[model samples]
Target: MIEHTALVVGGTSGIGLATARLLQQRGATVHVVGRTERKLDPELIPHWADGGDPAQIAAVVAKAGPIDWLVVSLSGGEGAGPIAGLDVATLRRAFDAKFWAHLTTVRAALPHLTPTGSITLIGAISARAAMPGTAGLAAINGAVEALVKPLAAELAPIRVNGVSPGLVDTPWWSGFPAEARAAYFAQMAERLPTRRVATAEDVAEVVALAATNPNLTATVIEADGGARLAALV
Candidate 1:
């Protein structure tokens, strides 16, 4: 029985798609929006819009009507680079795709969100891990994660949380040639305590918990396979 409705922006692929599928399986009516449309399960409703655009997001949220959960998993383009050579434009784009998009979605959906509903923001391990080459990404994701506590307090009764994922096997790495991507994943896996990269479904499980568990709020759950701890050590 579908007991709730979820709006998953960026839900066309990767962590977003996996989350949508998981929520559907758990009996929630799921509506997904992405910059582009992809073939998805018939049960998953699809919408197309640029997450960076507030108007587009507003339209989608309006169409979704009332929602019990709003999951923002939009990805900005690549922003990783050394501090000395980092591109300002890339950092801005990243913020637009992630931080601003998250805020805009929340704003547009606030009226439609159930008072006891939840909002889960998807971030990355780079935010908390002091990784040398990830300064740009770290700033972008850090800003997103920083919103959890304040939003949770201000939006009381309406939960707000975040999920920071480590390196995962998803299309987000498709830019790397197949062999190089494999080698990189292997190297990172060896460094992680888990000795393996997480699957999209693995992170989705954490997202599901954050979105559905009323007792949890003002929390930023790390699903990064201990990458932050390993980085500190």
Candidate 2:
């Protein structure tokens, strides 16, 4: 019943990879597009591209025809810090990666989506929760979240939704040393209501739900371990 062709942008690693594999398990044939194909699920069809490039995205989606689901998890992290000390280059990179790139991909894939097609954009808890040092993330993620409702309405039969996760432990933190990452996770665990960090698979499950459910649209579901609630306190 889950049989369809799915294109998962940023499917090389982390939540994207997890979602790619999950789709396979549910009986969908999945094509994964990303900059690095090295970490992709072997069962997935791999296509390489820098997700920030509109030309590349257009080319890639052109080949993955008649897609039933479009999952865009493409992202970039400009290191967190005070807003006053923000680096312009890093901020621009963040916007290019998280916001503008998504816009490009969505437009390219829209024509190819099947009549019952669905799109799930990977967002973040930063959109709703304000924590110090995540100003850039908040801005980009919030913009994407804001676009969901309008897209769902305009796209009409083509459902659009968002999956927002918090403090996920993924290759994104590879820049940090092992112990430092552990310390950060431990710190987050104490504050989050779930008392634990989210795994890529955890968020991927929700992507599957949002993509498969016919009625769920124009909504941003939180897959965070209660991160937004903590911010309110």
Best-fitting candidate, measured by TM-score? Answer: 1
lDDT per residue for candidate 2 within 1-233, as digits (tens), equals 44799999989889999999999988898999988649555689999987778789888888997899999999986736789999988898889988888898999898899989999998898887888878888898998888899999999899999999988999999999999999988987998899999999999999999988898999999999889889533
Candidate 2 local lDDT, residue 175: 91
For 69-132, candidate 1 gives per-residue lDDT tens digits of: 9999988667888988888887787788888888888888899999889999999999979988
Candidate 1: residue 132 Cα off by (Å): 1.0
lDDT of each: 0.91, 0.89
Candidate 1's C-alpha runs over 4 A off are 231-233
The runs of at least 3 residues in candidate 2 whose Cα sits more than 4 Å from the true structure, single-residue gaps closed, are 231-233
RMSD of 1: 1.4
Whose lDDT is greatest here? 1
lDDT of 1: 0.91
